[model samples]
Target: MAGQAGRSAGFNKEDLSSYEYKKILCKKDEIKTLEDKTSHVSDYELCEETVNDFYTKFRTNHDTLKLKCDNENGSKCCRDVNYYLDHATGIFKSSILNDSDKNKLIKIVEEIWEPNLRAKDIYICERQTDLDSTRKRSILQHLHDLKEDEDYILSYTKDYNNHLKEKWEKIISYTDSKPSSLFVKIENNSMGIVENYKNFLDSSDYICGNNLNDLSAHDIKISTDMDDFLTTISLDKISLNVEKNLCFNKRYVDMLKYKASNLQRINNALSIGVAVLGVLLIFIFLYEFSPLGRFLRRRTKKQIEVDENANDEIPDSYENSENGIPYISYHSTSH
Candidate 1:
């Protein structure tokens, strides 16, 4: 979903047209997040190196092997991932901005990013594309590299439907599209992704099979699981920069989003705990510390005494009177 929402949001024709222009809309919750992220880094000057570094950094992540760079021959001034990301924060910040600026960002990436840089940088490629036919351990997206998408895998960070279908094909074949222990074993082992590793891998490079693999009533169906698998993948939620998912430097964009998500989750849990604690503290203050508590306790004690006296045994003989008045004995024992 880009820009504003549906008719319930009331969007006129002109506004809707502009909003649909490859737009990236910032949700209300994400505004504070965007500001925090923007301030954490410096503004970057747009340049060829700025674009190139952004590309390289996004491509190099935990999912892929480190690039071979010679100080003299290779990238002499290649910036590290975290530092360069800050240096190139300008692009990452664009995710919150949905306008003609998004188009500008894409143009900048295409102009400066060397065509040679794909999702799999030869070594990264080897790791990404390996199918594990012979059981060679490697970084696998769909568990066979499934060369069908290799032609354009390097072209963009987003792993296209064809690419995911390749992986899903392998998974379904092994699972027979039926839910069973075998399916779970096959998915957990290979081809099927179970976690949101957007921080570690490119958003487009892999399709997480988590939603599908989760415990559900329906068994895996190839038509829906494979043909309609793209519906299961939402780049808007998964990709850090939706505008740039089609452009470049998606991994770093995704990383920032990943970190922010973790922080948000923590904040949510802490908020609940804090609310509970606050309620408990208020109760403690009213009961043990405040004057109201003391007054309430005194009243409660008097009420309890009254209740006890009210419930005391009725006079059996009426022989004891505090005022020393003579009392007559009742014949209750005989009755």
Candidate 2:
């Protein structure tokens, strides 16, 4: 039977890429189901099977991959006993419109399946190889299906693919590729993958069957310490910014205070200057109006006349007969 329909039938580049991605994911899941079945038979069944057996067993009904008909806890009426990849891919690729659908589908698959495959036994060599092939195929298909060139996304994917290829080469050179590599790169690039994975986990709101809850208190402590370190750095930045603002405020306030003080000083000086000028004007008025000033003026006039007579003739000393008072006599030459 074919798979169920997706939420939207609207065709877009994203939708097309999603469709292609779903097909690729269907292919990967099919391989995983085969890998799981073979693992039960023998460890060697991973690689010993012929190409004909590879196709045959992979195409068979995988009971291990089947969903329960009555999964009351999780199925939520999606009890078709079909894998999500098969269900989503069938609906998307029934008709090929664009690559966006294919990209979206592949992203969905990676978002869903990678975590599951990672939590499984990490030592499976054939399983790891299959996952690598699947990852490469997804990356290549995405590159092919992009409607417009997104340089940044393309560059990031290329870098990520190159990293995966390098890891695969390293693993293949030493021992056959281990199943752990399925998520090793992802875990190493946790910054990139964790947020997307969290979104996926939240979207389905389901814990993956393979997600392990094996972290001890010590691991949690380490994680907490790392979180504290980041928090401390952020706090330090905030504190520095606050301190800078405070210092700027203080400087601005000081400047205002200084200006106020200067203005006060100027006002005080103006008041003192005005007072001094008033006192000087009062002194001048008193000097002009006083009796002493008039007497000084009269004395000055007599001195001036005496000096004029002295310039004309010599002055002789004379005494009054009755009082015997010494006096200066001035002779004037007739001109």
Candidate 3:
């Protein structure tokens, strides 16, 4: 029973209430200091009476203040306070006010809040009430600054347009001094070249089997129109010259072919003659070295010697008949 009594004595409700009272007093002193820093109109003692008075005024003018402060800046300020109060409570909720004095203000306001009214609603109402008088003045200042910016932009645009117009006039004047015929001819040639190039690119299948990368400069055939324009002013003259040159080239090639054929025939005849001469020489060599050839030479030599001897013998016989003429005459007389 003594231990129970001692335990009961140790737990004192009055001690807890005294500590809370001291804390509230310290916060009230801080609130008073914060109030001294704020505007005179917003200054108020941090007490239950002051909080109640402010709440009463806010509730009475809530609709009118909300309507007056219905712009983005005012709404954003109100929403910031509302959002802060919604997620926070107790002493920590005071930290949501970034300003040193604002923390004290919020702390005091939160302390005296009624159970029926939410902290978020009360904070939003307070911000709206404060914004009522300054909303119109701020909007007017924004309009004045916007008008100045617009005027400067208009002046800059006008100057830029004038500069562009002057440049365009100079360009036109310079172009007017140049000869139109030269430009016209150049433009026509350029257009023809572009058209020919386009056609050449489009005809990929015929160019080189649709593989453009493999195509060489020699593989590309220039369009006749483009060729004529680049090579000469008169297409007919170019065509006539080309035709004449082609005819001359064809005649020259035919002459070359005829000369080649004649040369080939002459070579063949010379080769055949050489072959016949070589065969004849071979036969003569064989005949001269053979036994039959030697035998024929000896027989011809013997026949020549026999003929000479017969001639000599006939001469001797005639001489002898002359010498013995007397005896011969007597014999012929008797006959």
Candidate 4:
């Protein structure tokens, strides 16, 4: 018995070892899956961080460029221009500028660089070696070219400034003229006789047809006088009080038109409803008197009679008959 028990104990030890080995293998697979998931998450986070950094740099550079360009008297603009020119080949490779912004930047760079290039050429010519006669001649030629380029730059700058000034003046004039334009619109809208009548109806305390007709004659006279005034008056002649009155008149006129339109729609809806109701009554009357309707009614009555007869013939009970056998009554026809 002792030897047999020893053999069983050895078998139990082998089984437990195999089970632990399988459990360890499962745990290793789980750890590997977790590591893969963590690696993917890290990669995504790194990509997002890179995108944010790119946008931040792009915005910073864009703002810096704007500030540098806006400061005409500062050396920073020159430095920025030089930097961008040096990097011009790789500038559009980034997402820093879209098509329109890139075009504007190119134009600005051209304006800055062309004048600067003239000055640079002049400086280079002045610093050239005087030992070589050929170099001296080349320097003289560069100086002449520099003088011509400077003259061209000056003329172009003047034309650009004048163009900007004209644009600014036009913008200022347009800004100043907006109120007058609005006033003109209001005046034209309010000075109409039909609009005046509508406005009077909308503004009146009572909104009935009688009140509408009663106010018409006075409004017509006022509208005619207002129209004459508007035709004779210039936009500049309109005072604050006149503008306010015109605006009020326009507001009231719009409200009146809205209300009148709504009323017209309501009237149309009511007329349609009445017509529909009349047609429905006519249909009901025709249905009651029509031969087809009478035939349907007769059919329905016959169906009800058949149902009643069927119900009457159904046996109320299956009681025993006189011979003591259960009797079921099924109505039958005899020929």
The worst-scoring run of ten residues by lDDT in candidate 1 lies at: 126-135
Q: Which residues of candidate 3, in runs, are more than 4 Å off?
A: 1-248, 310-335
The total of clashing pairs for model 1 equals 5
Q: How well is each residue in 127-193 modelled by candidate 4, as lDDT tens digits?
A: 1111132222222222222232333324344332332232123222222233222111122322322
- Compute each candidate's TM-score over C-alphas: 0.26, 0.19, 0.20, 0.23
lDDT tens string, model 3, 1-335?
00122223233322332122222222233332322233233323433354454345444333333443444334333432232232222222223234554466556555543222333442333422222222222222222222323333243443323322321222122222331211111111101111222211112111111222222222222222432333322222223332211111222234335556766899999999999999999878766897876887789999999999999876555453465573222224553
Instruction: Please give the TM-score that candidate 1 achieves against the real structure.
Output: 0.26
Error of 4 at 172 (Å): 38
Query: On residues 138-217, what C-alpha lDDT tens digit does candidate 1 reach at each position?
Result: 12322223232344444432333332332233222222223221211122211223222211122344433232222221
- The lDDT of each candidate is 0.35, 0.33, 0.34, 0.34
* Candidate 1 residue pairs that clash: 118-154, 129-145, 131-144, 158-204, 159-204
In candidate 1, position 323 carries an lDDT of 70
As for TM-score, the candidate ahead, 1 or 4, is: 1
Give me the displacement of residue 331 in model 2, in angstroms.
13
lDDT of 2 by residue, 1-335 (tens): 21223322331222233233323334444443433343233223233343224334333332223222123312211111123333233333322425564455445444643334331232211112233343432322222223222332244443433322422232222222332222211111001111121112112111122211221111111111222322212111222332211111222234335556766899999999999999999877776888877777789999999999986664334432336666675568999
lDDT: worst 10-residue window of model 2: 184-193
Candidate 3 whole-model C-alpha lDDT, 0 to 1 = 0.34
* CA displacement after TM-score superposition, residue 136 of candidate 1 (Å): 7.8
Q: Which stretches of candidate 2 lie over 4 Å from their true place?
A: 1-248, 307-335
Sort by lDDT, top down from the best:
1, 4, 3, 2
